[model samples]
Target: MNIHDRPFFAPTRRLALGLTGVLLALTVAGCASGSRKPQPTPLEPVAALVSARQVWTQAIGPVDPLLVPAVHGGAVALANAAGMVTVLEGETGRVRWRAEAGAPMGAGVGFDGRRVALVTRANDLVVLTERGVAWRQRLPSRTFTPPFVAGERVFVLGGDRSVAAFDAQSGARLWSQAPRGTEPLVLQQAGVIGAVGNTLVVGIGGRLVGLDPDDGRVRWEAAVGRSRGANEIERLVDLVGRVGRDGDVLCVRAFQSAVGCVDAASGRTLWAQPADGATGVQADAERVYAVEANGRVMALRRSDGARVWANERLLHRGVSAPLALGRSLAVGDAQGFVHLLSRADGSFLNRLPTDGSAIVEGPVLVGNTLVAVTRNGGVFAWRPE
Candidate 1:
């Protein structure tokens, strides 16, 4: 039987309803007031620095609002709203394999070579292999981020304020750990986890934690930002978007708070700059890129977090995370337009339009192609010309 179809206890249903109401209230209060300025409309393209043409397009299924494509081993894996998983060839967009979970999916696809992991709407973890279904384990709570598979373990961050690791091969629970602090209500789109060397780097509620992947013990912890307000709504500082790491330097952003980088090994704060954004930060070898809540994209020197450049042309366009593509940076907007800007000076170089729906997640760079999935369930691949 599908896990989501299982019955819920009366008390559990009540608690879920209460949490839903709280989340609704928080969403309403989070939007800026009438005092805020209007956003700029997308400007006309100046000149084409590099031509981008769609290589292929495919329809997996209806869009799973929370799912983003996972790329590994020359393949891009996508989970649609209908609980179907499709693996497409990176170069040609050909379907390699397709499978179904028999239930709706909660989060995106997480993959590592032979194994793929996904979370179900019922809060269960499902692992798939080339052969077929490997194992399925019920999770303690719902998850939004993809299951992070590294080494022999798969780590999942739960909305119940915990990070749990399971044996990748056997689906046995290895260990579970939570952050240290009062659990402020977390955003549904908030948590992010990845591996930095041997440690599992996880961002939850304004703090970045490095966990020992083997035992789920705390290796190091650093605050990306802290709450200063009195009420729960005022204290909702979460690490937004995906945690970015280039070498030993890891950078992340806190919702309505700050963006900073730290040493992945010891959790030493390299430098932090005050900024407000719901999107995450991206870093190359030398600089970190951030899109503020207002849609202004800023580039900072990775060494000391000095401001390199800021582009305000796309202000309030609902930009996704900035993707570093060679000498240019790419960002997708709410209107499904991908804008390419100069990496050195933030000058607008080119723009391309998709299905006119929002690219809910940041574009994934696969080899020389940019893979973008729209909210309308359009998966597109563009190659530079």
Candidate 2:
């Protein structure tokens, strides 16, 4: 018998089954009594990373807004849902400049040299050089990754799974690929990184696809996660990973179990090892690290994907992306605790607190200052001393 069809037992299981069954059954039949699931434990506060005097707080927009900031040149550029991109000085909460662009959506902002490029909801590549319109190209479908600018060439992927290359100077399309899927998820930039050589590692349809920087040719392909259930769509959603490349090792979040490492040149699986939770993946010279969604931090060897160490304390249910800052590894959780782990053994080094607030968006690291954007409309910065 199907799991959802099974009779509910305890209140916790009954609530969970009822919710799942309602989605499948489309209506609740007979519930002897309505029962609510036990609420998850309230997240306790982690220690602060900086002293109270060192804290800086600011408001950008509404609560739960998708105003993710992109760090560049000691400044954080935030894009609002209304298609406005605002540049803010990193050290202070002062706004440098703001410009209105396209309709607000969840596209990303990219940087090449001093220019800021935004992918609009209209599927257009808008390039802003020195805060001015450098050029704009109207594509056929929406784009999610801020144009991958490599030198003068900007590589972009559309909702159709077709990768296109355009001249950065002009909006001239150099080449384009055919659409891959009817409802392709390639438009979402899962993970992108320019490798050591002329190789570019991109997550296409939740799978890691390597391409040559010279021309957008598929050099290699590696599946990062295993398929789940029978439906193709359900399996694709579980194949989530933010890929990274250091030298020749391709680092990606395989599953909740481990980070999968493959040879960048040959597309061969080197190894896969255990991690704390399903988190973001990052890499440096020494190790490949993941900050599991449950806020645990883990480090693995880059050569064979072997576990180096892992720390789960001071972490929350949801966590931020891992930052491999050579000697230190940083991650922030929803509970507002940003932990710094030693790259050598994954030992806890410092904790950056969020002043009792929760981090909803980021634990972005630029230099020594780690910025945590909170859910209570506060952006807190911490520099562990």
Candidate 3:
């Protein structure tokens, strides 16, 4: 399933932070590209004096309606609406693997570096290795989001509102627990396993729950602001989970336009601010950057949730989450355009049309190359001139 961008409001106070000189120079030049369609920008071209390029391009599926492809370990893996996992090479858009799951694999695919895993709407955990099916285990219900891969364990959310852990290698049932609420919509990547805190954090409808790394248990829980109305999309909008020391901090953006940051350690509300149409949120040691639903991007202090800089002209609405490339930010929108912005001041940098009709899935930084994925299943790699 694709993430939906929702709107939210922020306090009026402007955030103050030191801006880097090198980043400012890049930001100004990156935004210099005019708002006109043209040939694909050459790889290793000049923008703000720095070189860039679009190195490679490849199409994945049938490219019918266009779907947001997920990036997994040097590959763009797509579980098309037809219910199959298609893996494409990261550097070159070459097909690495394809497997039929029979039903439409609704839950987006996830990878543990070695294997690509998909939990279908039918509650089946289909794991794909290099050769083929490593293992397949049925769960309780349909998985709305990708599973969380931690060490040798993979965490899947069941339709019965429980989180189950399976051995990544052996596909053995490690542990399972029915938490009070559902897990978050975003999937998580594992780092150091069983270090501390919960490994999985999920927000079902309006409540957030944390699960144990060793065994799925109730580490903590918090109630988020819910949306109103009869057809009130009972599910939590889109949640972005980021790793933290104590636990992962989940940013849940609701359709009703509310944003909250919950600490997975104690299941407490760290801080929350009014926000609307927030697409993607990325955090650094200093601040968290977010792309609003209307294509407006803003940065806020990681500590107090204060607004830093707001750039509305970078890209338009229906763009993918703003991706961070060191001091630079890249985003692709509905217009099939990739934009590079300055992370220091949220200034526009370069705008290049990928010459495709699909929504941009990524401005993913693969090594020194910037890879943007189009909805038409095309992958374009850009590099510095």
Candidate 4:
């Protein structure tokens, strides 16, 4: 269902009668004014200050917005709903390797150069290597966030709010964290999971928790959101998947609640601001960027969480999470157009095009090329010229 503010549910399975779905529809309608969806803002004449060119195009079949292109050095790993995973050279768009999971995938392409991990709809965590499928392990619950591959281990954030670890080589169960309190409803979208320093940082509900990677012990926790809504559906506050990382500090969004930065090394909340958005954020050294409910792009000062600039020209465009590449901010819209904006003042820099379909997720940069996969499964790469 297309909500006027933003997407609360990117449904692959039918949630036709769920209370969350119904309440979300009502909640989004309350935010919008007119009876019909707003038309996307028309583009003005393009500025020729920055020049970019299409580098290469590859196909991997159609993908949903859940799939984010994983980059490792010069290689980028991507997967489609049909379980076809392809690794391509980022610069030349050459196929490095390809593998199939033999089932419909739920989430995937978590790569650490040598190890690739994906989860199937049937709840199997499939790990692949350059050679082929390395091992298949059954998970305790359904997963949305991609398996985070690091420290010779695969860490997964399950939809049930469980965290488990497996050996990268043998697929042996090392440690598991049981679901943390009873949550009324959890987001079907991916939650943030990654490694910062020696601590494995994970988003469990609205709290950013840091656990010891060695034995999976809780080291510290920082709250980014709280359950203050009137109902269970409104009370749902889960961290969106992507992150803005500058050294040990990480910035993440608590679904439609707040955006905050956390110190991974010390487990401290640097700052937080009330923000109504469902997608995660991107950041550079100076600023943290987010796309709000109505497609407003905001740049927040990294140190103090102050508003730097808010650009509303892309409103109602159904833009994806932004990619902070070099000096420009790039985001793909529903019509398969990538708009580049100035990072300083959020001015329109340039416009790029792809096959007429939504880009599946945010763009990933590799070696000087920005790679993006479309909802129609068109993988396009653009290099600055």
Candidate 5:
């Protein structure tokens, strides 16, 4: 008998028949009782604490829900769903250059100072220089996380729980390494890769692995969260959002599990605190900021992982990842409102409105300018006065 076809309790054939009848009766009873899943909390208007104005706006075509803009040097590189890549002046929002890909973009517009890399929906990697297309290569598997470019290498996390590196100048494959354990269930929106010193930090399967960039060898691995519960769904604990790093500290959040920090060099866990967030965490020098799955914004002490403060007024507002900006933390909501909260107390400091569409991805902090992209392909930049 298929385990999924029948409830676990109905192990015997006779019990399975009876369980089916009982389940039907219970389903009818539940319907009669008018049981329903809990609805998200309604959004409430809050008075702005400070004034934030948009410096500029640009229409770049609709962006993929999983991809975020890449900022390098003083330019921001963005790829829309239609395979158009635009490089803009970070402060002025002036379009510097634009390129169109042969296929729809799947993963990134990961930019270093030299080259830009993006994956196509056809599972091909396309690299571009300032002039035009540099090279194109096929990936071994699909990818949702944006490609990470550092030094002379570009790194990507694939759907098959593997991390691969390629030459930044040429499209040659450097090395590919898969994570340990069973082919664990992966989260669709929960993988990230970046460089911290000489180590490549990858968030996958509820853990963070520090890999040597030169050879893609696992230098160390640290668990952000562990699997628990009876079923695979409940046991899912992949790390969500971007892995945050500040100096020697690295922080990450696990889906519906916990948030933790670790020493980047030694792989020693600094601290892990229970947190229920679907998105990732961002860090400044002192605090790590995160949005809980239900839209609660939280600030945790970076040193020991203690709760600094939390604001729940935006609960269920579909908050994006938090961006740490000096004394404030900025997060976007479903309604295209970019909220700035006090880093000290989590109080609302200011709010800015976009094109009235949902800000699906978190804002990127380029220098002092906060850049945000809405679901409708609206891009805006703001700086705190």
Candidate 6:
């Protein structure tokens, strides 16, 4: 579900099913007028500036906010909401192994070459290897982000905004932490957890925090976005995923607030630009790309977060987070079309058609293959030829 329909947390009374959802629903209903929305920006003819083709596709059933393709080299592990996890050889769209997690999945498919970690709908952290389900243990709360796998350990960023680490082999709990934040509402989206060298980093509220992976000690914390709204709904500024990483640098998009880059090595805020975007960002060495909440595309210079260019051709099309691909960038729309744009100018290059459903998550790149998953369970792979 999109942000306007995503669930939110109220500190005192957070319901499991119906009411936590109404928090954002109330925001949308309370904020917007009854005026009918105008149509999405019409598509124009595209002159293919680059040669790219969809090479192969696989069906993994429908997906949701969960199911980020956990990519390792050319292999990608993906799961559907129904608990079917499939590992694919990305280069050829070949299935390496498909297994069941034995329950409905809440969030998942965190793969680090060998092991896969998933949070089940029952609040269980399930770890799987090629041999099958390795170990399963219950978690303290719900999790939306996929478990982050690194250094032979699996990290879980919980829906309650806590951080925990688990042993990949025996499912042993190493450390659990509750970051210091008193925000009443949080976005029900993918968890942002990653590693930069020895420091373990996680997105908690509006800050990207570096913690000692061994003992859950806070090394540093950098604020990428700040809360400023009159109410909790307007003040939601948690950093979303589709983050761009170059060595120690992480380029991220703060929900409904700003887009910024953080030097994960030193926990320093390199620069943050005021950007009203809901999705995350993708970056290359020179520039970072983001899709605005209403579908405007932007290219920001990587050095100081300067706006390089803006393109509104896809405005209101429900575009996914961008995937930087060589001289072009790729994004999928709600209509199941992948648009390739010129990296230097944000101009349209070409559009590729899918199964006519929304791309549920961001586009991913594995090896030379550009990958995208749709809401209808279509997994497509494209390659430049």
Predicted candidate 2 versus true structure: per-residue lDDT over 156-251, tens digit per residue: 755445677778788788887775655422213323433435565565654667776566778888765654434332333222334455656667
TM-score of every candidate: 0.90, 0.73, 0.71, 0.91, 0.87, 0.91
Each model's lDDT: 0.75, 0.55, 0.55, 0.80, 0.74, 0.79
Q: Report residue 56 deviation for candidate 3 (angstroms).
A: 1.3
* Model 1 RMSD, rounded to 1 decimal: 7.1
Runs of candidate 1 exceeding 4 Å displacement: 1-22, 25-40, 182-184
RMSD of each: 7.1, 10.9, 12.0, 6.2, 11.0, 6.0
Total residue pair clashes for candidate 3:
28
- Candidate 4 off by > 4 Å: 1-35
Q: For candidate 4, what is the TM-score?
A: 0.91
Better-scoring candidate (TM-score), 1 or 4: 4
Q: Candidate 1's residue-wise lDDT over 1-385, tens digit each? A: 0000111111100001114313443342234453545655657657887788889998876766577667776788888877788888879988888888768987767876577789988878988876777889998776877787767677898775589989888999988886455464656763577776567778767788877777788888888788856666556777765656676778888777788888876789887778877777788878888888778999998888889999999987778877888788888887888888888999988888889887867788776788888878888889977
lDDT per residue as tens, model 3, 1-385: 0111011001100001112211122211123343443333233342563346667776554432223345545666666656667776766657788877666564556664567677665668888766777788987654545665546667676433456789888889998776443333322111111122324566544456665657666677676555543321222233332222212554444332455666555678777676764344566656667776556778777676789898766434455666666667777776577777788997666776775654543466554667766655566777755
Model 3 residue 106 CA deviation (Å) reads 1.1
Better of 3 and 5 by TM-score: 5
Work out how many backbone clashes candidate 4 has.
0
Per-residue CA lDDT of model 6 for 1-385, tens digit only, reads: 1111001111100112212323343333225445666578888998887878889999999875567777887798898888888899989999998888889888877887788889998889998877788999898776878898777678899877789988777889999997456556667677478776677778888888888878788999999998877866677668787688766688898877899988877889999988887778887778889998789999999999888999988888888888887888889898888999999999888888899988877778888998888878999988976
Stretches of candidate 2 off by over 4 Å are 1-58, 62-69, 88-96, 181-189, 193-195, 237-242, 254-258, 265-267, 273-278, 314-316, 342-348, 355-361, 375-378
Clashing residue pairs for model 2: 48-353, 49-352, 49-353, 81-104, 278-293
Model 5 whole-model lDDT (C-alpha atoms): 0.74
* Rank list by TM-score: 6, 4, 1, 5, 2, 3
Superior candidate under TM-score, 2 versus 4: 4
Best by lDDT: 4
Give the clash count for each candidate.
0, 5, 28, 0, 0, 1
